[model samples]
Target: MDQYVEILHWNTQHGRKLDAAIAWLRKRAKAAGRMPAALMLNELQPGQGEHVGGELGLLHYPAPVDDGLDPADSRRRNLNAIFIDPDGPLVPDPEWVANWTGPWMPPATLPVNLRNPDGTLSSRQLYLACEHACYWHPGYRETTARFYTVLGKDGRLVHVDGDFNAWTVGRAPLTLANVADRAFAQNRSVLCGTALVADDIADRLMTAGGFVYVHGHAAEYLGIEGADAPTTDHGPDKERQLIPEEDQPERGLSAIDRTYTTAELIPAVIDANVITDPDVDALADHKPRYTRYGYPDLVAITNLPVELVHH
Candidate 1:
């Protein structure tokens, strides 16, 4: 039967956000109508094991070594979630205890394709993915996003960055959603259609959520465009004018174009049917946030790049 999966994503590194995370999850459950039948907690440890043993109850023959201790404790550092069930023990997947984290798709759960009404949060599973191995890496960021995206099934996934230490995810999901999710899918009773935790390079952390909004940090594609656009990580894709092959350009000196700034971006969103580069408007805030966090970033956007596309 198609059920609902309420997600609560939070970084367990500093682990101080435990209380807040729990509250958010409880709210998610309340909105979903019923608590999850099973919870899938990612990045438990040891090759990101899919472990089922968490703060909540269980079914069938339980597994050993329940690291449900308060990960908030410095010595324990075991970030776990609360699993609740009264019927019987929620049998752990064979691989559940094979490692630290439990199987992403609980034993009886199916993969989320999000192709129909049955695809979305219908899994009735609570998935809590937290922290990288031990350090912070872009690989972790991308994979975590991808995994959550899968859980979201076609863009139904809701990415909540418990912590944005290295500026993990922000306005990035907006584009991903456009590509993976439905136009304006609202499944859960609570929360928006989607939410991507965001932040800027200069500032701390800010929450980013919404259908067209994806946030981790604009740093990946923020200011510093122009002739130098191609020098950044996303340079190859940044909006830029390519020098024709006929123009036999200089050796080391290559071709170039400019990115779009919010000033020239949002107005375009108001009228245009398609945006070649939506990244610019994804983080578009009416009140530019020079500080890097908060709703001010919705429009103000202290720093807007040039030549972004949305379509």
Candidate 2:
């Protein structure tokens, strides 16, 4: 079947990485003899005022068709849309973009109440709202954001000097209503702390439905006694650790698990991986996670029957 993919909100730095990904996909499609009809790359232009708009000029690439097949055949033209952002700075606010002139309009809007204490929308809030909107939007088959350690100039993982804000919402089946409720509730349920545990311990906690945010001095903060706590042995020294482990007692063990609201967990994961990664200041110069969008709610959407696309 023909697929439609749209990539939204990518900057110059992301362009090179995206190009490599697309090339790999195209090569694979050719091997399978199921190449797509067309691919589109939509860049984010500076929006008017505080909002941002997609660049009008789309970098479109048409697939090379077979010799005998007609290019206009409907069966030959499936659509696949992919949205790529190394760091998700732009929130897809449809209401704000309705009047704007562009081929791509944001698929959703931010809820009225998800604002900061000063009655303004924070970047994190805006991204969360967009994620909430995508969850329920019929047009999107699925969505996700992935978090990874940021690299430093010395060709190593960057270290976070300050406290790691392990922000967390609740578990999955997250909907717009509950997300808004959590965001606006006077005494909303969320988990925010700076605790780091042993990698094995973190893995165990995640297995139980919880998440752990680790960073510089995480070993000392969590009192990890093992040697694995301070090295880059299991991949990059993870800036943060997020597990699915639920809030519960340590039982016979010394570690403890805490459950979080969906609102708290989603942004917490994003903050650790994307919004506040160690290289936030030098994002353009560092290598970001290959797949930059993920959260439990979004992960749920991914398991559904949607066309998979990424950068």
The number of the candidate with the highest lDDT is: 1
- Runs of candidate 2 exceeding 4 Å displacement: 1-16, 37-239, 244-311
| Model 2: residue 199 alpha-carbon error in angstroms | 25
What is candidate 2's lDDT per residue for 184-303, written digit by digit as tens? 221222222542222122223322332233321122343433311111111233222222133312221121111111222232222211112342323222222111123333333222
Model 1 agreement with the true structure over 162-268: per-residue lDDT tens digits: 22222222211222222222321111011224652221221111121221212212322333123121211222342232222333223222111111111212222
lDDT of 2: 0.23
* Per-prediction backbone clash count: 56, 43
Q: How good is model 1 by TM-score? A: 0.27
Give all TM-scores, in the order shown.
0.27, 0.21
lDDT (0 to 1) per candidate = 0.26, 0.23
Total clashing pairs in model 1? 56
